[model samples]
Target: MAEALADIGMIGLAVMGSNLAQNIERNGFTVAVWNRDPGRVDEFMATVGAGKKFVGAHTPEAFVNAIARPRKIMLLVKAGDATDWTIDQIKPYLEPGDIIIDGGNALYHDTIRREKALRAEGFNFIGCGVSGGEEGALWGPSLMPGGAPDAYENLRPIWEAIAAKVDDGPCVTYIGPDGAGHFVKMVHNGIEYGDMQLIAEAYDLLKRVGHLTAPELAAVFAAWNEGVLQSFLIEITSQIFRAIDPETNQPLVELILDKAGQKGTGKWTSEAALDMGVPVPTIQAAIDARVLSSMKDERVAASQVIVGPPTSPEMPDKGDFIMLVHNALYASKICSYAQGMAMLSTASRAYNWNLNLGEISRIWKGGCIIRAQFLDKIKQAYHRRADLPNLLLDPDFNQWMADAQTSWRSVVSIGALAGVPLPAMSASLAYFDSYRTARLPQNLTQAQRDFFGSHTYERIDKPEAGFVHTEWKELIQ
Candidate 1:
């Protein structure tokens, strides 16, 4: 009989799983590796796992048996049916206190249901959201683990050792219970969509209206990376603009197809927001932008038929126009984060998650895809007031928006005049405007609903009156 020497067992030897396994082993813990296919295990052991603290296991029984007591097994396998199947395979061999972690992009509701099912069997299941792509996994990714507090405590050392470090603190945190981790990750993706779309709009306006070339645009983005807009996305955008096609000797971005692909997280964020009655219009617009991008064929056909606007618009002052676009991008980015933060705050209350918004923002300051310098400001904002309704209300963000409003409106107007669609940017501007306004035309909408469906409306003038229905047609007559 062999002794249980491995600290952790990792199933699924795919890119993310393999990298994460190496990361765990690199932090001085012995890791046991397995795969759905035995060949992958052999291959990993022969290649990357070679000369490392890794135990390659061939059977599910061997994998579970090799791990120490109160066994910790992480599944980096596909979400949905695959995750459930993997759990079932090893469930019989696990002890009561054993922990199972699913580190994949899963729906939060599914995570909640899985936790309930596993709890019934005396096991702890964690839905952990890992972010930062392939490189981050190999190095240090931001980790979001949602489960029992004791389960998190069991995995704390390994997670803290492997997560990205910023200002001497790790980017991993206990993100409440049940599905909070995955829900927060979904919101992160939604904000990422908004970020990318805003950057794309800024690129378009600079190219079409300001007449900047690829290298010139790259220089501009590089400059932005040095200032308040410094972010992973902005830095990468600069790199993307500078990349050249080796085959054609042209700018790579120009040669690439316009269509954008999504993996459903952004849509999930929007759907969840709609269901919760939270206004995530900027996130919704980002998803809609992707949907519109997919209709490239229709767009090309429409380009042929549409004859109203000229492609060549009068160019604006280069320096001043660049600043305008910068301010517009910054202002819109604030609105998108405001909406995402609001969603998180609402979810925390609705689900009884007790999520620490400041801690969440702090964890996002490092390895996540949406990592930004502005996140520190958000962390500070929430730290000052945990129950703050929205990021837009923060004094710093409020003043920034106030100063940028004219520039933001001008950029949107320019996009409309130039026949360039600014879906995310314009939607963010609208979100900001609508949020700040005291009175809206929705009263008319309420009256129309009451007249048609007798849904009823509330009276503003009468203090005691509530939920009243009106005979609008008879009153008009």
Candidate 2:
């Protein structure tokens, strides 16, 4: 018997890994697979890999040996310790110039550390971000690969072949060195958090204030999906509202628990932004909303104890409210993207990643969780002005904001008066307003900081070079 060779080897025969392997095989490449558990390898070989051109290996060494020279092995294991352990297990079998691609939702710093350690040992480590869940793994997902140019060059053909296409171009690109790909993916998840929260807020307003039934809300979301709001999240949200519970014969959404869960990427984004001194209020607010939602018992108790205005605000005209909610959602979404992009810009500069924001937007236009018609406009914005400091400042987005401001404000105000929680929406509006303001109340904040902690404050009349401290209680001292 001859040793079977594979173009690429993938470890961790989980759903994502198996599907991605199948996708690679379907695209005219032979894939070798291995899993931590032998049963999984045998199961996959018996099932999804049964008819595919696959080489199933029971051990890491076998997986490495089955691949062709300068092996391409991708790890789709759990992030953190598992990723490190897998690398340790496979390192002995890998030779110089071989590539190891991590396709998990890892912290960016972890990717950076691993890349540096591997590259020093003559191996290429690529932290690749794969988006669009199981279906995407089997078909086409947006791929973001970050590593040395040589490694990317070697993997480019396979990546481009298996990636989603938009406007006849693959949704895969070299994001930059080290962890740039995973960093972008983390921000993508953060923005996804903001988007979902904003949509949920809109739904709450429509249901609580406008008194719409679940089916009616579904219709509204479905209609919005045809316009600028067209995106994966919105499309699924509409479907979610329309789903009926098999047991209760009521809308499944209503029957579900109110608690929301997270897997850390959103929290990582917020933490990274804070550490970098970048403001991502919309993302932060979305995370906060989830934290608040998780306190379902506390919220229920508080609702009974903490009373608001005796009556809820009267519902506005349905036609007008619908348009207002639409504008509000669109405007807030723009702000959320702006915040995320701003964070990316800051990160790029700080880390010397040289990330191409325009290319990032282009790749995000399809086969990602955040894919949308609006991303086309975003791509255009970045293309028109490669150095676009913020999406809110883009000419088209600026004009859209101007047109939407009145309705956007009305929706927020109405939600407030009706006691409907609109954390993400309100935070986005606040971020937009703060960005546009030439003079913020931050001066007072600075002064208070200086007064309490002797922190220095910069004067508006002086150049940015100097930081001065003021004395507030000389006599008391």
Clash pairs for candidate 2: none
Give TM per candidate. Answer: 0.98, 0.97
Q: List the RMSD of every prediction in angstroms.
A: 1.2, 1.7
lDDT of 1 by residue, 188-250 (tens): 999999999999999999997788999999999999999999999999999999999999999
Residue 168 of model 2 has an lDDT of 40
Instruction: Give candidate 2's error at residue 279 in angstroms.
Output: 0.6
> Candidate 2 has what TM-score?
0.97
**lDDT of prediction 2:** 0.93
Note the Cα lDDT for every prediction shown: 0.93, 0.93
Q: Deviation in angstroms for 399 in model 2?
A: 0.3
* Per-residue accuracy of model 2 over 28-126 as CA lDDT, tens digit each: 999999999999999999988887799999988988999998899999999999999999999999899999999999999999999999999999999
